[model samples]
Target: MFKQLFETGIGVIAIAMLSWILIWMTRQARFLKAEITDSIKNALGEDNRADWGIFSLIFIAVFWEGLETALFIVAKFQEGWTPVLGAIAGLGVAVIIGMLLFKWSIRINLNQFFQVMGVFLLLIVSGLVISVLRHLDAAAIAFSHISSSTDLCGIGKNSCILRPQIWDFSASLADRQFLGILLKTIFGYTQKLYLIQAVGYLLFWTIVGSLYFRSLSQSTQLKPANKFN
Candidate 1:
């Protein structure tokens, strides 16, 4: 219990700090919503107005994301300290990288960094969609009462739609073991996924990937047109 609480505290603090860093970087990028900017800038001189407007936008965005991330870290930390430690290490590395980028005058291509991170974040969100579906399926099974004679393989409403096994890779990577745990933490991997989980995972990635690529294509087209103009 103490470990869990400690992990949660660490998670919360790390998320908050990261949120501040992200907000700062986003402001440096000059990426503020037009309405938010205009509304908050009404009282100030034009030059100072833009800065405060961006700050306000960053504050709101960071607050909301930080709260959400805190809740998420709390939930995930229950799995074990490995994830918590991993998150802490990741946060530390990010801080060091940020210091090097800013304080040490290290150069990095911001556009490329954002592009790569955008794709990675999208993949993580897709994995989350799968994880949520699997958790729901697990909950449904707990509520379901299975008789001794009942077939375990049946699907749909009349039978166990949730627990109809799709595949088991326990022989290779048992879910609770080190490698399995790391994979699961990073990619939402599972050795004993069910039919519903598989279907949901495929569907989520398909939809999100299509939308993502479409947006990228549109942006690419717009850039060339803008350049020509």
Candidate 2:
């Protein structure tokens, strides 16, 4: 009972923080979009000292992203310190890439970079849905036991209404194995996947994929018209 409350409280707070950041970003999307576009084109060539506002905007944007990431990391601490290590490694790579881009005048297609990162983030969000469901299932089961009711489990002692394992691939690829761990971290692979978890993942991808493809189709349709002009 207490464990469930603890987990729920922490998870809720972390999600709320991240969601607030997301909403704030969305609300400031127009200004941020223009600012970032101009900043990238200038590539720090402009005298930031002259325009203190631009520097403040850049600092605030970076700080918000960093704060959101920190909250997300806390939310995912159940995945262990591997994710923290990965974040550190990724930060190093990002710093190196930024240096190379600025100092070396390396050409990078920002559109492609954002598209790839968007897809990666979508996958992570889907995985988080599964994680949330898994946690909810545990809490529900715990509550059922305390209340002396089998409502959460449904049919049997081992059977859970929300988290009944749909399939187990542990025989073929153990989740503890290196490959399994890699997939789990990257793509949220599970040896014992639950029904609700699968549903949530599939539903998320389905909706997101439809919207993404539709946007791509619209962009493709508009490109020729722009070129003709």
Candidate 3:
């Protein structure tokens, strides 16, 4: 009960909050006073002795993401270090990436990063649908297990894993169903995958990942040009 709220609630609130903030930022942009704009511009201008525009961007992004995650932890967990820890870990990764970006001035391969993260999110979505089915089955008073022998299993190698037994979350300390729910919310997963979802996931990952990595590979091979008047 508590676990579900902490896990799922965090996600819902964070997304909503982010959306709200973006809308507010857009609306407030025109109202920003020229004095304020000039001050910020001075701080961010490329001519500044301390190049802060990049840092400012990274700081705001990480801060808001961290802040939202923290609120989620408090609201859903009712009070716990889990969300804080999660935010910290995420921040750590971002910091490492930021340092690299600053030290090397080379543009990061965002395409590849998006492809990797996209594939991971897709798998989570696929898993979530299947997990929800299991949750419903568990809540059922007289659930009957179906046989893999059903036509859905497929005639040959493509056959589904025969009436897949819903995952038993009991083995782990926290009920896996509950944990799976948490993962589905946080990481995303599906227990019983539909034929189409599986194919689509595979196709998207293959196409996107391939293209992104190919771009990276090509970029790496490009020779450095001498910049002179």
Best by lDDT: 2
Q: Please report, as a residue range, the 10-residue window in candidate 1 with the lowest summed lDDT.
A: 220-229
Model 1 Cα lDDT, one tens digit per residue, 1-229 = 3343344455445434543444344434433344556666674654665767778889999899878867877887899997788777877898899899889998776555775775676555555555665555444444443545554434444324555677789998898999898778777788877777677767756765565555555554544333222
Model 1 compared with the native: what TM-score?
0.55
Error of 3 at 117 (Å): 1.8
Q: Using Cα atoms with residue i matched to residue i, what is each candidate's TM-score against the true structure?
A: 0.55, 0.60, 0.39
Off by over 4 Å in 3: 1-70, 73-78, 138-229
User: Rank order by TM-score, top first?
Assistant: 2, 1, 3
How far is 31's C-alpha from truth in model 3 (Å)?
31
Q: How high is the CA lDDT of each candidate model?
A: 0.61, 0.66, 0.49
The per-candidate count of clashes, in order, stands at 0, 0, 13
